[model samples]
Target chain A: MSFVSYLLNGISLGSVYAIIALGYTMVYGIAKMLNFAHGDVIMIGSYVAFVAINSMGLPIPVAILLSVAACTLLGVTIERVAYKPLRHASKLAVLITAIGASYFLQNVALLIFGANTKSFSSVVKMQPIQLAGGQLNITGETIVTVAACIVIMICLMAFMKYSKAGHAMLAVSEDGGAAQLMGINVNGTIALTFAIGSALAAIAGVLLCSAYPSLTPYTGAMPGIKAFVAAVFGGIGSIPGAFIGGILLGVIEILGKAYISSQLADAIVFAVLIIVLVVKPTGLLGKQIQEKV
Target chain B: MKKLSKTTKSSLITYGIVVFAYIFCEIFMRTGHMSSLLKGILVPLCVYVVLAVSLNLTVGILGELSLGHAGFMCVGAFASAVFSKCMMETITVPTLRFALALLVGVVCAGVCGVLIGIPVLRLRGDYLAIVTLAFGEIIKNLVNVIYLGVDSNGFHVSMKDAMSLQMEPDGLVIIKGAQGITGAPTDSNFTIGVVLVLITLVVVTNLVHSRTGRAIMAIRDNRIAAESIGINITKYKILAFSISAALAGAAGVLYAHNLSTLTALPKNFGYNMSIMILVFVVLGGIGSIRGSMIAAVVLTLLPELLRSLNEYRMLIYAVVLIATMIFTWSPSAIGFRERYSPAKLFHKREKGVQ
Candidate 1:
């Protein structure tokens, strides 16, 4: 592939990665917990779509929206079931619970979906959008995924910046105790954060199906890890950074695969992480917060 | 004061019991009546015991929630497998080749352990979890591309090839490939495995009970306080990690030699295996060596005891894990309620270091 085409593939992947990264960053910002199960939540989102499109025979758009809704509810339910009870526990306790939640979700998926891989129909276009003298053949799915992610991110940014509920979320993320004292419903905002993050994850899941039709219980593992790298690269709590990092990481990964050995691509991404730590530990686009003693 | 002395004396005697246990295994393996199949079970139990315990060294005693302990094991497994191959191939003297191969494997895995440790030791929370997860994937992928020295498929020789190289005129040595490293000289019977496990147990027990171990535990409890109190948190983290990695490497060496297989199947050692060993740590209670030991044995044997249960084995394991977490790791484990709320537990410990 030529350089322009390489960059284009990178951006297409980057957009999907950015959407997923937002989920990790937002939950981390609010809960200060890694939500190890978030990757599994993405898994749940994919399966939700599988049931909708494959089993229920719903229209593609309806299936996509239902998957997002189901995941949003599931995300909220996870908080109430797993996290709420551990609100005052040690980091290790909560951490383990998150892992437990992850395993629980995966095992349940296995039981429900079986160990076999689920095939999916394109939520977007199966046809490629040919452009620029056959140099660029963007898939209809890629364009929709990129456009949808950009829109959701913009709306999230606007809500956090301007909307009363969104600002309440900001307060809770900044200082849960203080936010509580100021009469904000900290629990509700936290739930809202999970719900929104899960919905976003659902969108990424749908996009993944459009891109790669085979879905397995373990399918979320790679994408989740990559988006997490994006969240860290951009700065864990910085929304804009998550977007920038996610997309940039996707591009680098693809380009690295094309130009360099695929074996070294992962290494190169992590090498970027190691270098970033030496240069700016808080991440690129992230504000440095002082460690509280 | 009395409790400390008794505990110390009991732990010291635990080593004696471990040595005795190995001797018993030696006798059992040599006895004419015992089946090789039984020896297989006993021997693998020893190696896996070391693996689970060494991993517990990081996940349990050190209190670092690493999700890549198996990656360290892979390093150990591959290093040993590759070494055994080179020695058998390069050296004409069969005995010399065997010894060198095992030696090279252990050392290479030890080095790999240290290399992966540097960037990750200071990381905390789920970043460590995710990074280790990434590290595991990277290792698994790297193994896939190693070309295992050729075969009928091509130039990748596997554990199968290495095993075939080990020969005995008296008909003692045996080897096999993905068929499962069949002829490995069968040197890795129960006694050797048990002896290695004992050595690992001793090293890990000593390390966790040392001052460095205390520092690790302290760091896990309160990072800022431990650092302020002059604990070199990062140093101890790396120290624990490297040592634990070395121990897991040792186990992998024992596993390959005993099984007599040179197969490089990354699929076997995965995130689930890491999680399974971690379940041993948590089910037994983290920060407790005795807990790790007891949990390792039970977790290892539980699947065997459930042979009749078969497919339900994983389901049972999953259920047991979920229940354990709900019972022990959850805030509700202490019976938190809406009337008092979970946050009250914090106020009670507010004067204490977080």
Candidate 2:
């Protein structure tokens, strides 16, 4: 029963990671660049939601909507101002620029929010569920988080499969030049990807804060990196890969903390990633491309 | 002197600059012209220069992005600090102890580099970058949990807390888990730092212009072509990475020795530091050794320079970072430079003279 509870907790945590990883994987796939700022966008989302609820006296759902809208706009703006100029530049340049953007966002947040850690009020109002004569209790945040993750994942998959914009995204990811030649607006598609990814980031931010209930300028950094690892673990360019990778990573992290030394949990998780990458360089779901002479 | 080669001339200038800076700083200190703040940053400035230059070896010359350079530095720092602590009484001479500790730090970091590189180098591009990042975090996380003590019955280590070490009554705890090592001798100084910086510059600059350096660059330019031309890709990659790691380790030694308490904080040894070093390399101009040194010094000092603006310091720094990237790499900026470059004007003046 305790193991079952741990697994549930892992899934809930993993669900948040998956949501963030989805943003990372999508941006990487479409733009062929890592948006290091994507993590900070999550931080911004949380802050926005926090302000909306606490200061503005807005309802939870309204605050969430506002956060999502703000993040989407911010993502598109970041893409245009910081990233678009580096489209034809080297991957390294784009990465550095993304990093710069990340620092910019973090500093801005720091200046506005100060360095204090805010105890976030949970947005989820659902009642806790008890099982096995109340020995195992699952919090409302966990249920909402897991449910939100699954719903988001399913909707993303279906949208990518059927929507026109999604097909354009697929085409761009496949080959930007070819897609451009085929009359697809590669830039537009990339922006849309950013918009959608940022929206998901906002949701992930809310869920993350609700579960962990702490907010800071750096709240998203570690989780962002972990989700990125998850994205790579499952297979970088694949959607389903991010899901499986996030869940597995979360489970490993939780179980490692439970069974092994909690202090070494992060080490154990990273070590496993190294081993997995050694076994499969492209990642579990990542496609292998032959070198061209 | 008879006309020196371009590489030779550049290398000479680089050495000249370091020596000149050291002499300049020493004179300032003697004349009481340097501020306490500037004086304090002198050693750390050297450390950053070394880090920036060493990381340039991998990111600039070798063309592989490593996000775990700080992990190597952490390994180097903790190894040296541990050694220094354990030998505090046994080793009577500070100089000898410090040198041995330095060697231990370098060797440990280099070995870790090789171990990490062997498996990690198998992956390419972003995959390789991510793996390095993972290794770096792993190193930091593991270091945070480590508990080490030394007594009459040799050394004892435990991943648990300090109490779990079960050392003898007279045992001294060198490392107390998250609390980290305290009381390590401060054997580092601005002079030693500058010397190490010079040493690192010589090694890295020489490697960049050597036959192996050419081979490494060739691999970076075109891996397939280099492999076809009989270049040992795996060997060179590992060699460059490990050497770079060793240099970073040396920087870590300087860093560790300068402080009384040495802890592997994320701010110091995490991916952020690695990224900061990378920023130096990129902003300086990738593959340009002198540029890296200059960039490291300027960027490290910039925040201090902007201390008056306190709240806006990092904000301005970020803006500068973004602006520099755009200026350096954006297509319009490149075109603008080509159109109005000083080199082109100089060439035109020579043509007119002819």
Highest DockQ against the true fold, candidate: 2
The lDDT, on a scale of 0 to 1, for candidate 2 is 0.93
lDDT by residue (tens digit), candidate 2, B72-125: 999999999999988888997877888899999999999998998899888899
Best candidate (score: lDDT) = 2
lDDT of every model, 2 decimals: 0.73, 0.93
List, residue by residue over B1-354, the lDDT tens digit for candidate 1: 545666577677767766776677677666766666555577667766787788778887677778777777777766666566544546666445544655665676667767877877656655567577667766765665443332333333333234444333332222233333333433455556666777777888878778888888888788889989999877888888888888777777776766555554545566666766676776677766666666776777776777688656656765566566666646556554533665776776785766
Q: Candidate 2 clashing pairs?
A: none
Tell how far residue A79 is off in model 1, in angstroms. 2.1
lDDT of 2 by residue, A117-229 (tens): 99889999989999899999999999999888889899999999999998999999999999999999998999999999999999999999999998999998989998999
lDDT of 1 by residue, A26-122 (tens): 9989998877777777888888888888889988889888989988999999888878877766666666677677767777788778889888777
**Residue A280 of model 1, lDDT score:** 70
Candidate 1, after superposition: displacement of residue B3 in Å?
11
Backbone clash total for model 1 is: 18
Instruction: Assess candidate 1 and give its lDDT.
Output: 0.73
